[model samples]
Target chain A: MDSSPPYLSILGVFALLSVLAVGGGAAVLPETKALTVTHFHWLADDEFRDIYGLGQLSPGPNMLMVIAIGYWVAGYPGAALAFFGFFLPSSFICFGASRLWNRFEGSQWRLAIQRGMAPIVVGLMAAGTVSVARVAIEGWITAALALAVFGILLARKINPAYLVAVGGVVGYFFLV
Target chain B: MSEAAPAPTAPAAPAGPVPLREIFLTFLLIGATSFGGGVVAYLRNSLVRAKKWLDEDQFLEALEISQTLPGLNATNMSVIVGDRLRGPWGSVAAFLGMTLPGAAMMTALGVMYALHKDHAVVSSVLVGVGAAAVGLLASVTIQVGRKQLEHVLDLSIVAATVLMISVFHISMPIVLLVLGPIAVFIYRPHPKRIHLRRRHHGHDIKPAD
Candidate 1:
């Protein structure tokens, strides 16, 4: 492993990710993959892929990749810094904005802004889905599983956690 | 046009604020147990279903708003819901609630990752988890798409986007730049109908629940 001061690098990467992470953290995935795998050479492509998988399986935000990357780089402290850097700025901005939002609660502009934002958000989220699928869905088995999960979610109304659990069992037997 | 409207019955005073302490603890629990990439579902269960803090419509509206804003949808929604419930302070409370625990857990996992970078058990578990995560992402896409993509235009946008990104390997940022503005322009509400509807309904517009 490249033995630099990884904690600092982790902090810097996460802070940058926080600001540029428009739409959602997933929007930054391709760049993250490139930097970690192709440029920095800190993690191999497969390792980067695995960390992303863990981020997806674990809860909270898929941006949890910061923590995994931090771990790969430095140790617990790197993880701490990565989490703080990734989360704090956005938290502060939203906290401050909430105050301003209340002042204009009744304004027509607020409604219009909300109306305008809805579709854009949906579009960005769709983009995020594409980014993840491109990296993760490699084989016919994986593709079939993805389709099955999608059908179960949209058509069957099954809770998603259960689908993940079932997929884990199947994967252990088949894919793993 | 300038007629004095009857004084609106005092809009129900905004409910007394939820204590910041409760918000913090609630989010902490959410952060800790939010395994398997079900943060939204977890929030829906905890806040909307269990706590009854936000009615379904309110929760849905917040979800919509969070989706539009930049950030994690769950974290953004938590801040919005908290802010609506209390004030700016509530946004902090909700944000910390949702994030701190998960951050701590992941950070610890990072330590383990460094130590056991080549362990067989770790590798095996990751293999299983990674495959499952693929399933989870697929599930989320379907759920969100069904709820949000009502118009044919919206569906078309999603299909085109999926094709461009998945098949053609277009970069995400480029796809976003190209598609984001087009969605906004195409989906802009019909102005004439909005004005007519506003006039017919009078000024006593019901606040979104």
Candidate 2:
């Protein structure tokens, strides 16, 4: 069994995702899940959900879960590649685009583009939510938890981290 | 402690070169301490309120640019604000600062997860967390899309996009390439509309007759 891990492909997948993450990491969740779970078979759907949960528990961008997928596929080197692949291209584009954007300050076309992209970004976010829901929502308890969290967030100003933690405790008692 | 609560009526920050190290440290603090996903609030508090590196208008301007771009808003803001402060290397420092802490922590957690993948308690807790995360994402999407969701054209576009991706399983590139231009064209600047809108904005206010 020759098991050296497919380094180039891991890099390729994440790099593609990086560029396509218009509107942010959440916007590309379905694509990310598709590439990793279906195309590459790098992680199972359940595992993908679990890794995403780990990301939520952490303090920074929840998309840092990509590193876990990389690690699972090709160990530490893969982790490094996924991080670079996922961040660099998009960051580089943003850097250059921002410079150009400043030149067109107050341009009508700029407003047009922002207005147009807004709805599309929302749509993409909706799809991302569905992708997670497919794997994460098992039954009524999970469904109820999701609803409660959604309602609380809409109605109040509490930090979401607290809700996520409370979810874990609830799961500890109920799910297990 | 007092530094944390700098007087609200302090004078404007001096318009001088900020040290690259300070930019890095500021972003580093933001990256490490900003729990949950809303780094925007932490950023506004630090840059606008505490450090006074940018005024409210400047911060919002940076935020608009960040939101419009393709990367994470927190990282994009770091880059734009960092560049505004001290050019390209400033961007590097800020990007590194914004991502490093989370990357390190996530990597550690990844290792821990690998070691204990089959533990029943760990698995159950993760299940709950994932479900809650979905809720978080739903709330965020609603808030962000609230404006778009109200208008018919925007709502239709939003609906169409979800249908293509979630139902048809269309790849992202195809969706962007096809819909992106169409959406842009729909809202493309019309000369008459621009002229009328510009007049309303105090662009060419007339004297009282």
Best by TM-score: 2
- Tell me which residue pairs clash in candidate 1: B27-B97
Clashes of each: 1, 0
Return the lDDT, model 2, position A85. Answer: 92
Candidate 1 wrong stretches, greater than 4 Å: A1-3, A6-9, A20-22, A25-35, A38-40, A102-141, B1-17, B48-61, B84-89, B150-152, B159-178, B188-190, B193-209
TM-score of each: 0.75, 0.92
For candidate 1, write residues B1-209 as lDDT tens digits: 24266544333233466789988888888887876564677887788766668876677656655654556766887788888877778887888878776666666666666678577666545555555565566555555455444567666776766666556766556666787666655644565635632342222211222
* Candidate 1 lDDT tens digits, A38-138: 55677775577567766655557768778878777666676678777777766666556644654765455554444443344445455555555655566
Clash count, predicted structure 2? 0
Q: Provide DockQ values for all models, in the order shown.
A: 0.40, 0.75
Report residue B175 deviation for candidate 2 (angstroms). 0.7
CAPRI level of candidate 1: acceptable
Poorly placed runs, candidate 2 (over 4 Å):
B1-15, B191-209
